[model samples]
Target: MRTRKSETELPRFGEAEALRLDAADPGHRHLFHVPPADGGRHPESAYLAGNSLGLQPRATRDELLADLDAWGRLGVEGHLEAERPWLPYHELLTAPAARLVGALPTETVVMNSLTVNLHLLMVSFYRPTGTRTRIVIEDSAFPSDSYAVRSQARFHGLDPDTTVVRLTPRPGEDTLRTEDVTAFLAAEGDTVALVMLGGVNYLTGELMDIPAITAAGRAAGAVVGWDLAHAAGNVPLSLHEWDVDFAAWCSYKYLNSGPGALGGVFVHERHHGEPDLPRFEGWWSTAAATRFEMTPVSRPPSTVEAWQISNPPIFSMGPVRTSLELFDSVGMPALRDRSLRLTGYLERLLDEVTADRPLTVITPRDPGRRGCQLSVRLGEGSARELTKRLRYEHGVIADAREPDVVRFAPVPLYSTYHDCWRVADALAATVGRAG
Candidate 1:
């Protein structure tokens, strides 16, 4: 068990300070497998790239092996005879996933990858009619989301160039302001069939105001949805309370479910049981009790499971179940408290180290406006080379976005304040060399 520290017990930027903070952190580094040093030239990497991919949990191996054993021993019977039967395997994650996102169990389901679920939800929510035919998204949205939305428009026989609205940050701004978003809705809300934005942006690490944006879009008579690939497991969410219509997220990032793990979806209860709501459905989506009856009639369940198009992938879901169990154990509230302090500590250390450098933090400084990530804009040099040096020489794992930005996400679950200090120290050295 880990000991809790009062807010006053938090430390400043230093090795001792990081050690102290790590000592008090309920989510310890031992829970993960930090990348090993290469040929003893450097220490274990100070991994600050959870924004792209999270480190694997130690328990993931055991969880997967158990499923393998079941598959070998039970054969087809594994669906109902194994320890954790594969037939209803996805149900195990529903409660924990709902807890992580602050939604009721019936409102959530774990299936498909992030973009696929978004497309699936859009099929139902993005009802582009005669006038309300536009789909709204940010200019800096992940390429996959952009493609999905644009393709969705084309699928409806609408020209994407004219029908898709891209909300961009103002002149001389790095992040989108909520005011700008609301203002766009005010002007073109009636024309928008769906308002889909990243809950936390991938490039800027900016946490958008979901409730405000959702309410604004709804007021403008548009269905609102969120792509939470970066926000889930990194911040506190109240999707139900916020009145968000639908949302989807991948588990491979902060959720620490290995790469390509199953994704989760949230469909607000208000949309459930509405027969008029258009959605794609399949056998697994029907009521389980009568699913095997193989009747031609489609009796979709009265829950979010009605959106599931196929049966659960038991192997892919094993690691996710293990990861969600950890979230359930520690809870999002405690994890979020630690994330604020850890990221704040990273910000301070970056300021101290880069005070004389040409780098600038583009991520929002306000705690409520961001998650664990801090995206720094590099000046006077190549970001790719600096990122390379940070990894090969200093053993710091950070991601570099093309042309200018380097992103560092010090996850509260396995990263330490000392890790934050090391990242800054390594970055300072790299920048000094480049200069």
Candidate 2:
């Protein structure tokens, strides 16, 4: 029940520390509700799924309640007359959301979902010209991203077989090295028009070197874009400093902004004034100063908001605002420190348990090269079944990817050190049962 500083002086998480951590976690102790099953009381499960969906913060309810009350009292007038007018609601969040991704307010906006934003950004940046029409991405990118990029290429009447070049890791390797990506870019630089990549590989949890990749793409005369669905909240970023041309990410995952929450996009300041770039504009994207004039003045905002096609759902903003407020209170640096220790502890534990087993970690070993998720490869088809046992019998909620891989992410915001330990133990037992 006492507060403890997660400082260097604190003992690194082991079995006992992990247990103590679980007991002290507010999410486990207070908010989590597990139904009675098998005619018995069930303790809260070890929730390692924050990499997929974050736990709702306790304060989210109060924030939603306030907005709901305003909606009730003001009705349609809530757009301009509510406690927090919906007219500039998105603006109120721009500063904090910008800080989360290391972007200027003018360069970022929360509007559509991640994949939707990626496509929208591509409309402006992915201008394939004749021979320089190829797009580069990882072979193991999130399925949604790969589909979007392929579809984008197809829309331009280009064949993906030639236009989309997917970079794969070396034989027998699990994750890509920075040198490999840089070499590939150097080799095919002239032909590539755009480099659209996942900032963190969804399956491997490998945090791609963003600044280096952005630089390489630019040096190769390729416009760079990042699908930051996994990287946005899990790691520190300086998109503005990196000179990244454009980027997009979801809020439901690490951002904990509720299911299918509004996504965000970033465009560097250099592109803000590029009037020649193509865009699909709507009334929302028109200049705010003359938005209510009902005239066809197409003066767009001098920012990423100019990309918006329609009014964002006002209710969706509630969870994002509440979640971001929590992130602001516990800054990224402090949270990242905890994440490193927790994931490192898990890696060590898994190594100890599977020293002689066929399990191999596909995620990068370096703390700097990964977020919280750790991907483990079972030599054969052991992942799906093992994950099943962990969930039903052990109460560990890790996800299984197809073809022998399992991913576990211990999110620092809500997950505890003990959750990692429990899953590790569950993994060992699951392997034993499989054997």
Q: Rate the local accuracy (lDDT) of all candidates.
A: 0.89, 0.83
TM-scores, all candidates, are 0.95, 0.92
Which ranges of candidate 1 are over 4 A from the true structure?
1-13, 39-42, 433-435
Cα lDDT of model 2 by residue, 1-435, tens digit: 111233332223367777675565423224322222221123667777777887777777888899999999999899999888998898878988999999999998888898888889899999999789999999999989889889999999999888899999999898888899899889989999999989999999999999999999999999999999999889998999999999999999898888899998899999986879999899898888898898876788888888988887888998898877777878888878888977897888888656755678989899999999999888755677777777787778878888788899988777777777777766655563223
**lDDT score, residue 340, model 1?**
94
Backbone clashes (count) for model 1: 0
lDDT of 1 by residue, 172-220 (tens): 9899999999998999888989999999999999999999999999999
Cα misplacement distance, residue 368 of candidate 1 (Å): 0.8
Pairs clashing within candidate 2: none
RMSD of 2: 5.9
